[model samples]
Target: MHRHKILVVDDEHLIRWSLEQNLKKQGYDVLVCGSGEDALRLVQDEAPDLILLDIQLPGMNGIDVLERVRDVDAEIIVIMVTALGVLETAVRAMRLGAYDYINKPFNLDELAIVIKKALESHDLKREVDQLRSTQPKKFSIDSIVCASDSLSRVLDMVRKIAGSDAGTVLIQGESGTGKELIAKAIHYESARCDRPFVAINCAAVPETLLESELMGHEKGAFTDARTQKKGLFEIADGGTVFLDEIGDMPLSIQAKLLRVLEDRVFRRVGGTRDISVDVRIVSATNKDLLAAIDEKSFRGDLYYRLQVIPLLLPPLRERRDDILPLAKQFIADFNREFGKSVHEISARAEMRLLNYDWPGNVRELRNVVERAIILESDEVLQLEHLPREMLSVAGTSPASQGLNLVLPADGIDIEDVERELIQQALDATHGNQSQAARKLNLGVDAFRYRMKKFKLL
Candidate 1:
């Protein structure tokens, strides 16, 4: 890790030398300047982590240097040092973005405390900025890419219902199908956009800790509870809480969740007082809740409360039109991150992408694209960029004979061979039309027409 750099600016050489010596002893890299002009020059050449500036300076004043520093990097922490009678100037310095004001003839210990606080504040701001960069921006639903009638209809329902505040939403989809993304889009686009959005994975947490995680616990509630702590629900008051994989929640916790939903109130784990929260509930699950209810694995009442507005997301294979676009998006993303210039995919590789079954859905597609980008050497990705299974599927149709008959081989009619394979696959699957169509890598309607023409259906 690079050293934390500190810049000290004061016209008094003795003061600057003493400050530099102290900061260097504390393991920080220090830069000393006799005047504000020299300080500005150092800032422009190599930006420092923090600047300790004296208000009184020769030539350019400290305030002028601070103004230039702020223009260069608003996030840089600045501390203004002034004499005892210059409190009013210090106040003006704060309005101009000085982090804190320190009076002269001050204790070194006190000054050290202020510096620590300023550094901590700067570190926290950096962390927040990083988190914001990773998180999807608010109200931008375009990131949830899909190109199927089923998914488009689901998105339309989400948009329409997102405006309303009364109904609870239940998002159903297979794992890796981006359920959490949908939940975020709903919360960020709603009236409670400014409020907190707390998320918890029901399946990820242990059964023993689930209650305490959902509801607050009083001090000494358990052996580890040294002090009282608010749970996720209390922290998310007047906001939204996303319960991912809701089907995996224990039956006991499910009952508690149901009570919270029905009455909008919950008691802490070991506390008598009840806490009321005006929160919106958004739950998602990969399992069939109705089946779980019938099997007594889940509470029926809670299921009903969660399913007020149901949204089902289709798996990637079901939305074949989105494959190429999603792959291209991932490719561009990885190229910039990995410092590669891979620009295009070969036609053969593109065909293989469309043909293979994406069992892991969108997440799987992203991984494949990233892997291909890493392995690819040239500007275009060839068939070798894909996994062996995908390549094999592209090489031979399961419906075809055992003979190795490559396409465009020895005057063989490619169209005739394709037609025969489609018929065989349909016949082999015993007219289970969708499965046969999937096996042949052809759309259902096209497979149906071919089956009829070949008199195989």
Candidate 2:
């Protein structure tokens, strides 16, 4: 119930006094200024919520004073006051961004109405500005680099779902496929952007401890439970809870999680009463929940509940076009972080990077660029700056024969040769499936399926 502060500026003392009295009667805190200089100083120091400015000031004219005040804080509402028949001046003031204009010898009732309207508009504008400030910049969306049709479709779906209040969204993808980034984008774009976005990794925590970590525990709930604690669901009451690696969530806890999702109610581990909370759930996992359900590892009911909005993120190899763009972005970010002047990549390095399969996806590329920036002293990242494995893959030529086998002298089906090379790469990489896939320029899922098809696993 804080009163709005209003400033009254006029060379005429009588007019200033009358306006102050009227504004005070309307429950506004009024500050009176006799000259434009005093008004400008007041605006700089006090920053009143609204100003009633007279155009006929002694030293600085009202328009000039308004311009200066705008420089100080453009959002502050300014209402221009002038003598009657100064319609042209009022229009000019409006053009210069005055909130409204008032005429001298005006009706007190009309002036009060104008002030009230102006105050309301100013308050609304301030609220909108505050909300805008809370939102992440549009440029942050560019951070999600993707060019594959599947990935693009997933992004569109995420945008549409962000506008709704859907209870749960489950993102399914291979490891290093940017699932968490998509979760962040959804939360940042949704209505809950102003609230907290809490994330917990189910696989990273032990089965014995995850329940307490999620639902919290009452004092003396267990050996180390000395103090009562609020759970992640309660903490994210009005926002989102990102459950990463959800496929690995323990089955015992899954039942409680299902209850929370279905009933919007949960209880502390040893507490008696149920606590209802309003929280959006966005879960992600590299493992296939269907397979886990078939194996009696994951719950089918929870899977169905969590998949209200299912988004699948494509791996890096499937979206090759984004590789270079993502690399360049990481380079720029590393440049700023490391305070280096390296601005370009050598031709060989660029070719190697584009040709090599990035098993780690964007996260791996960022790590590679950060390593190069840290190790390289030159202005350009050269081929030598790359890891040895990447360099070896880049140097592999068709004519080279290995210890395992030799190619036919005449020729072989290029596609057959490519498949053989992929298998050899997989073998050489010691069944490090992701690394082998990268070496052979194959997508992770495709490589995995091929390995199983060929009994190479």
- Model 2, residue 352: displacement in angstroms? 1.9
Per-residue lDDT of model 2, residues 37-64, tens digit only: 9998998888898899999888889999
Candidate 2 stretches with Cα past 4 Å from truth are: 1-68, 71-135, 138-140, 394-457
Across residues 1-457, which tens digit of lDDT does each residue of candidate 1 receive?
5678999999888888889888898888999998888998899887999999999998888888889889988988899999899878898899999999888976777888898788878888888997775564633477777666777888888788778896588999998888998999898777887789999999999998999999979998889888998999999888899999999999999999999988889988889998999889999999999999999999888888899888898888777777877888888889999999988876556665766667888899899888888887788987667775555434355455343333321234445556556644654565588988988778999888887776766
**Model 1 misplaced regions, further than 4 Å:** 1-139, 394-457
Error of 1 at 343 (Å): 1.1
TM-score of each: 0.62, 0.62
TM-score of 1: 0.62
lDDT of each: 0.82, 0.82
lDDT of 2 at 301: 96
Query: Model 2 shows how many backbone clashes?
Result: 0
